[model samples]
Target: MNRSSARRPWHQHFETVGSITAIVVGVAALFVSFDQSRVMREEIRASIWPALQVDGFASLENGTLAIGLSVQNAGVGPALVERVTIRHDDSPVEDLDALRALMPPGADLSRTSLTGRVVAAGASVRPFELRYPAEESDDAIDVLNRLLSRWSAEVCYCSTLGQCWVASDDPGAPTMVDSCEGQPGGDF
Candidate 1:
């Protein structure tokens, strides 16, 4: 046999090694990209988490003539209110009378008005007129504080991503917990 007819062993080994190295690098890059994508998605979800807080006590806004209860969205994103169910002493509060009964035992609530319903991020519903019973009270602030200390309300809200939860100021408030896995916050 002629010597020239034999294959070059060194060249063949070099080609094989180069091909294996290229394949390993490509696979590693693919895995890294997937990991990065997952991290990005998680971060996006966190940025838009929603949290709703219900301050059932009636209050007046600055330069406003009316007083009304408030709901605030204290999260990073806007909150869409699904339902607002209020209870006073475990009894459903459907009207102003029920709400007045739940107040500081001396609230009139005759001039009550619902100023706003939609709660934006870091924003509160407008104040509407809320009257209190003709009891010898020091001031409106004192009455509000007293009422807040003994208020009960439950609000269900959701985010743009359709994640939802139930929140309230009442102790041991229950959360709806629907499609909101590991959401940013709970009771506001």
Candidate 2:
């Protein structure tokens, strides 16, 4: 109605606009903080990622033919091996002795326990090794071929960050898992 009254209403409108702007800015800051936190978590997990692989080797050493199975850590972080399930024809192999029984006579066998072992990055551990005289290389080759066809090995491992995965000789292995608990097969 009067000049002073109209000026007062305009001042009030300015105050309301200021308040709304402040609220919008505050909400934007909160969202930015949450997004930054999510990115930080992803970076930390990537820094400690672990990848395990099962590999087989056949070589000649000191006049003996050696056949071996090894688990290698190829990721940047160490892998804590939780379980090892070795199978023959879809049935779990009980232990080192039981695995050896499947080999031919005169084939010397040795193994390292994989369960609860920590394999450092870029390191490897032989879980099974068999050696015999080079004179019997033919039979050893046959045995190795047969064993490879029927044998399978799966290793469940975790990273330092507590993420777990299952690695095996099968295709598309090294799948992410929730945890290594209740993995099948005897501890070996």
Candidate 3:
């Protein structure tokens, strides 16, 4: 072949090389995009799962011994509570007022229990309280002891992504369910 004709093969070779380079670049871009997407999904899962715990304590609030129930979110995200059912004497105590009314006349209770609550990560909600002066620590102690024996609370909470859980002050580990629609803990 002549000189001009000989250059045709080199031109075709250059075009083939260019097309292969473009395909390799596109595949690399796709792989990088997939990796980034996977990482983002993992981060979202870590951010949305929540863990909550319920317990009681005798705390010093306003210079008085106060018996209180505490619910805390120890997870990475906020806990969206669907229901809080408090059981007393083997029955559902929907009204905290009724429990307060059962207390002695001198006992100071605010019915401030954290019910139907949403707790953020690393946050605590402690509302159920019965206050007693320092000299009346025995009253506080008695109330706390009575509450431990007579009361059990269950919290049905969820995550922002719609995952659900049931946590209880009763015996056994907290169980995770698909939804709170059919799963009601304790009496309520």
Against the true structure, what is each candidate's TM-score? 0.62, 0.85, 0.64
Candidate 1 per-residue C-alpha lDDT over 47-88 given as tens digits, one digit per residue, 9 for 90 to 100: 987677666454444422223556667778877766655554
Q: Write the per-residue lDDT of candidate 3 for residues 43-90, one digit (tens) a residue.
A: 997787888787767765566777767788878898888777777787
Off by over 4 Å in 2: 1-15, 136-143
Candidate 1, backbone clash total: 11
Q: List the residue pairs that clash in candidate 3.
A: 112-127, 113-128
Q: All models: lDDT?
A: 0.59, 0.84, 0.73
Superposed by TM-score, candidate 1 places the C-alpha of residue 50 at a distance from the truth, in angstroms, of 2.6
For candidate 1, the per-residue lDDT at 27 reads: 100
Candidate 3: which stretches are off by over 4 Å? 1-43, 60-63, 111-116, 134-143, 170-173, 182-188
Instruction: Point out where model 1 deviates above 4 Å.
Output: 1-15, 58-68, 94-118, 126-129, 133-135, 138-150, 171-176, 179-188
Residues 31-107, model 2: lDDT tens digits: 99999999999998887788888966677767888887888888888999988988889999888888888767788
Candidate 2, residue 148: how far the Cα is off, in Å: 1.5
Q: Ten residues in a row with the worst lDDT in model 1? A: 179-188
Write down the TM-score for model 1: 0.62
* lDDT winner between candidates 1 and 3: 3
